[model samples]
Target: MAGLDFLNGELEELKRQGKYRLPSVWESGSGAWMDIGGRRVLQMASNNYLGLTDHPRLKRAAVEATEKYGVGAGSVRTISGTLDIHEQLELELARFKDTEAALVFQSGFTTNQGVFGTLLQEGDVVISDELNHASIIDGIRLTKAARRIYKHKDMDSLEQALRESSGYRTRFVVTDGVFSMDGDIAPLPQIVELAERYDAVVCVDDAHASGVLGRFGKGSTDHFGLHGRVHIQIGTLSKAVGVVGGYAAGSQALKEYLIHKARPFLFSTSQTPAVAAACLEAIRVLQDSPELGERLHASASSFRTRLQADGFDTGVSETPIMPIVIGDSARTMRFSARLLELGVFAPGIVYPTVGEGKGRVRFIVTAMHSDEDLAFARDALLQAGREFGLV
Candidate 1:
């Protein structure tokens, strides 16, 4: 057998550069507080914005579905795996998103692939925000379309991309509704206006925005009141919905088209009965009780305000995901470790995730975090920040 030793050197280099990471082991559910390394820590690193992961209603729904339908779908969705519960969840998702229809995928990353792979083709043009998620980037790469990237949240840059892509078979303007690393919202209204002028399709990946933005957490389209104007909306159940799946919402024709054309949807097994039912219940929970989302925004605003007041450079964050910018990757990793030692679990974000020289710890404040929990995180961050001269 050939000795594969080169990968070891690559990994060692990553460790030396402070970019190597072993994911933290969470021994408990992703609640505001979680068990990590046998210690109960205040969790500020999760995307569970609505804290529905342990909601009694979601739990009950999941149990019931599992009892009735067993544990797995057993085949690809295009085959024998499409359950009635799956269709039901899709209906609820469409209703929540105010779209003509919706189609669920195995995960958010794959949802992007499915959408971009299915929709974009040769002679097409894809205009993407430079800071869009990796999934979006990979999805675009999978196509034969002409790709143009605009500066993050820069409408002028987006217009320039659109202008350059004119006369393509189809033009797309794709952006994240809320940027995950920085927590800043995209300039959607301006993007929409530009897309309209250029006759381009508008696709918003609302993975972080769902259940964290808009009235009743209908997502960025609803937040901007741009209903019926935007073309594609991508959302995730794994984050705020407190389950595991993703969906794309658009016209009924789009859903039907993806059902046939999207490789992920056609190839991957359907979302299990339990997950589908729980997601269906999650939508109901968000729609019926608006307080969940309100609490999330309120907590995020309060925590972000406190962080900013302490002179932390929380660049352009207007949402729950907060990144405390520290330029050096090694120092950023040290800060994150120190925070973990102090019982706050926020992970470091470094190169390849964000650009080199832009290293920070990403903190996600959920609705379930109590005032006391917030204060604990605040003090831990302050102490860590002081040691690193960040605050």
Candidate 2:
């Protein structure tokens, strides 16, 4: 058979296994309600947790920056792409994170790939949570380091892994501040204690935690009050902040080392001036407006409470990323399709993004969603659950 034929066969097998993914197209801006495939739908599937994506301040910043700097940065950051706006964004991020310095990447995924692959070497060890984001997993794979996986949120298992890798030159313990799939928080306090005891550098990917946790959404470190203990904090401006880019907050020396040695930062073009300017404005908006965060939390809590009361299994959720468990992948898809038909846009998450037999319909609440919107969504979901026998 031809190689092309073999690739087609593999794709067919994935479809048969209920694992093939085809994302829907959106034709509108990020908001509480969105236009999906030309239809208006209540959006419960976006990562815009704080609803800053469409904020007036961010839009204005982007517009002004575009007019002043044009569109693209035109070259790699190391050469001529490093604009004044990029430096300003970095400064704003460092201040927001309360770190000495920060380095911005084109995207969050590349940030992880750059940081892990560049920093770790052949005799080093990476002790990672089993449920870490795919970027981290791929980053670890790219490195020559020995990788160890500890059970999710199992501090004892992490400690054991650390103890077993004592002879390595460097040990890195990495975890997500918020487990994206399960919508659960990391046991950061315990993890930090373990890292300290084992002399391990702690790294947290706060992709979902930033702009949704702690006082004014300072992220997991601030939420747990372990700010200085976390060696590296990875955050995305695209999610809660409503812009496009990722940043790593750390000491000045670490930021300098990444800027010099990290392949992604060295090779990739810096973020567009518009994106960086928008991100800076986003940070300011987040700091100035506490109401947005409160509304988001209140909506999330209401949704969680209603779902639990309605007999839905929202697995260990402590944040806006709520997962309504539906064990069968096909059933989950049907539930999602039914939701779409009912003018709601919550999507079914299936393997291998999640584990087998753990398929769920993930609901992401935003500050823009009103009480009426939440009720509409809740009623739609409950109806879908009944229709699909998921309840």
Candidate achieving the largest lDDT = 1
The TM-score, computed over Cα atoms with residue i paired to residue i, of candidate 1 is 0.99
Q: Candidates' TM-scores?
A: 0.99, 0.98
- Model 2 per-residue lDDT tens digits across residues 282-318: 9999899999999999889988998999999999998
Clashing pairs in 2: none
Give a tens-digit lDDT track for model 1, residues 1-391: 2488888999999999988998788899888889977899999988888889999999999999999999999999989999999999999899999999999999999999999998999999999999999999999999999999999888888888888887899999999999999999998899999999999999999999999889898899999999999999999999999999899999999999999999999888888899999999999999888988888889989999999999999998999999999989998899899999999988999999999999989999888999999999999988988888877
The superposed Cα distance between candidate 1 and the true structure at residue 93, in angstroms, equals 0.8
Stretches of candidate 2 above 4 Å error?
A: none
TM-score result, candidate 2: 0.98
Stretches > 4 Å off in candidate 1: 1-3
> Each prediction's Cα lDDT score?
0.93, 0.91
Q: After superposition, how far is residue 267 of candidate 2 from its true place, in Å?
A: 0.7
Give candidate 1's whole-model lDDT.
Answer: 0.93
Q: Which pairs clash (backbone N, Cα, C closer than 3 Å) in model 1?
A: none
